[model samples]
Target: MELLLSNYQPAVFKCNTPKDYMEEALKICETLKIASGYISSDALIDLKRIIELNGRPRLELLIGMHYFDGFTKNQYEAARTLNAFLQINDLGFVYIANTLKFHGKMYSFTMIDATKSAVVGSSNLGSLYDKVSRQYEADILLKGEESSLIHASLEEIITKIGSPFENVPVTKFVEFNQLLENHENVSKVDKDEKAGILRNLTGVKFEIPIKSKPKSNLNPYFGKGRENQRGYIAPRPWYEVELIVSKGITSQPGYPSNQTFEVFTDDNWAFKCETNGDYSKNFRSKDDLKILGKWIKGRMEESGALKMGTPVTDNVIAAYGRNTIGLFATKDPSIWYLDFDASK
Candidate 1:
């Protein structure tokens, strides 16, 4: 019997506004009928907007925060917006953050799964860095089996990490204390120390850089009235490429360093380099070179990079020598080499 598998479709969006992101997401929501979402530190703002625009309806929402001690007034307002949305929709929302306790501070990972459709993104729900970043930087819409998995996971997490505010009824003045007590992950420090760490980790934490927009120009071949341009007028296909570099620690000190750079086409298959760089510089001995070579060759063989039916061979490597070497170290003793088309 033939086995069938479900395809994964992950969208990468480059957008400038919350509205645009929401519209795109809403379309996905309508198509997939998403029932729940998990929001990390960055996606809370847009999540709130989505809930509000969709008539403040109940949905499964799980919010995760790394730290909460330094949130500003505007940031607090964003949190209020989120709480209001949850209240009106009668939705389940979970806020996870590190907090200080009267005894000892602890960090907690929280979750809330009250709705079916869910969204996750890389934006915060506040004005903490308004001029620098959007309320939401990016979003991922989860549906079908994946959506169900996320919901279940969040629910399980929340149940395990019981909330302090679960049954408490408190006024505004005591709400902060409630949050601190409820969110086990929040930490407490003096004003001076908090400011110092804030300054030190400014750009390293949660600061998404604004990407410059590419200049758009009309294609000469498909100008204005040429809406139905045929054949070669189609846009070039996009390719996703990755380069991975790693070193072996288990082997002796003289063993060669192993590095791999892979180029993946739209098709799933990858054009991989099995052994095309020098490891002698780091290894400093022939034994290291041999060990590294053996290790790399095994990996390539396992990946079918040097398979019998495959067209890629030492010839192809020799042809791409310049490009391959450019990706690795220059001073290594063993030059880039390949041996292909060997009988099995």
Candidate 2:
């Protein structure tokens, strides 16, 4: 059948079943010597098979990080894993994109071989291959006029993924996934009451700088004062470090730098509950702050965010947001850790 749709809920179009569509797409590329499209699923099995085929065509791929159903840890992890896999594999070039702002889903493809064809559907490549689990999904292969529309849509996505935003390299993508996994593991460790209690009262582990103006003096309540101070803000005796909970991972479009976590602290500690710059939101309970501190520290160390320069004293700062975290030096924030895309 030229126009095929899989047998699944919300029936969509496809030349083959959901399970085999990916392989079919790859085979088409192999013959056509060119393939370009977008995918939202993380179906590794299909991906592996496609790679083994050695299509070696001029292929361009864009995988969606955000989903319409909703964003979940499992989904995020799968996307990261798939991105890493694509990065290392000889599958042409791949780019990671997230349209979380609109909660957009990109479970479609525009494969151009000897002729133009498209697969538009609700199913992701990863879910399509499932035998035990069932998620009804479908896709339609289009030619002629319909294929032209798919190509145009893909061109728009490519345009947005350029300039200040660029495709993530394999090395960086893999490192970020590893560190994120480490952070999750460390977060599950038993909480140290003493350390948490102590950290709740103090922001960083190091000694507070005595020379700079104390945060309390500049603004007693910590709101106005913290907001105004940039570059280097002196800590006050009663200052508790405010950890921000970012809305999305850094480097992705619509990832909010200023997001506040709900403060859940003891009577003794309170978060300033304020916004500072584009990267931080104020306050957490003394306890939550401590956990956040430890998580951030673990994430930083494990991710190599704290890599030392020629001088051991040279260290950098690391940040954690929802599903994404990043590393940068405090002295020069311009330099990003594992910055594969230097131009961006």
Candidate 3:
């Protein structure tokens, strides 16, 4: 039995020349045809490449993390090289590491058997470990029963952690269109044949319809680069305003607890005032309204609502209603219209 431990500090284990120990073990493996195993959280590039070069058909198990430098120019290419090696190799080995944390920081170790000898170390399957100082960083080496225990532990961890990447169903266009249709104001718009396709690809949960109108007092206060228009309400189509009151509705600073706004846009994209700031009566300043408009615009962009020619008129009214009243007061507002071209 031969023992090879890289990354082991003499200060901790009262021994120097950890590299010497690994070299001795590698020599023993070259002489004896025995199996080997390793366990570590970090690996070196040179160690990985060396194992691939030497232990092609004899290496039993190789379990460890794969680390890389994302800032390097050949990062992806180096990764691909490693992947190709894994794909073709038929050694009875396992590679265990989180794929998600690939570009940041990673660690892994491997075990190899040569002839009648076994070697274990905390070095990865790479080429960068040729430097003496980089190879002797941690205390990772065991043999005989101890080595067997480490190998078993590595197998257990691989089984428990499993692969991170798994297939998941993506939302389709019809589903997205149906969700938007569920919203009070949005469904009435003609489903541009393209709209359904667009919504399905991106995952967005459309709000249920709320039958509310825009306040005649609240107007567009913010613009791209224009002067602030104070107390100027844009002309919008008329719609009935209604508030649904339930028992347990509360107010929060940034989020609506139990309040919602419903706006019915006519074919002409006119805004109807609803909620009338009557639920909890928390007055919002002109500046707050402007900020709310910007927030809604951002949300629209994220949800791909702007591309559908969705106007900000209804959103402005909804924000006013939500800010003025608590979030829980109005559950859902239904906006219905007969014509779509009028609004655009």
List the RMSD of every prediction in angstroms: 22.5, 20.5, 23.6
What's the number of clashes in each of the models? 23, 8, 63
Residue 11 error, candidate 2, Å: 9.1
Predicted candidate 1 versus true structure: per-residue lDDT over 249-333, tens digit per residue: 2133422245333311111112233332433222211212222222222233334342211223454333333212112111222
Better of 1 and 2 by TM-score: 2
Off by over 4 Å in 1: 1-22, 27-49, 66-69, 98-143, 162-344
Model 2 bad stretches (over 4 Å): 1-4, 8-16, 31-49, 66-90, 98-113, 161-344
User: Cα deviation of 186 in candidate 3 (Å)?
Assistant: 62
* Candidate 3 residue-wise lDDT, 156-201, digit = tens: 5544442321211112211121212222223243446334333333
Backbone clash tally for model 2?
Answer: 8
Candidate 1 root-mean-square deviation in Å: 22.5
Query: In candidate 2, residue 276 scores what lDDT?
Result: 45
Off by more than 4 A, model 3 = 1-16, 27-76, 92-96, 99-128, 134-136, 162-344
For residues 155-204, write the lDDT of model 2, one tens digit per residue: 57744642111343322222232222332112222346323443443221
Error of 1 at 121 (Å): 7.5
Task: Give the higher-TM-score candidate: 2 or 3.
Answer: 2
Task: Please report, as a residue range, the 10-residue window in candidate 1 with the lowest summed lDDT.
Answer: 234-243
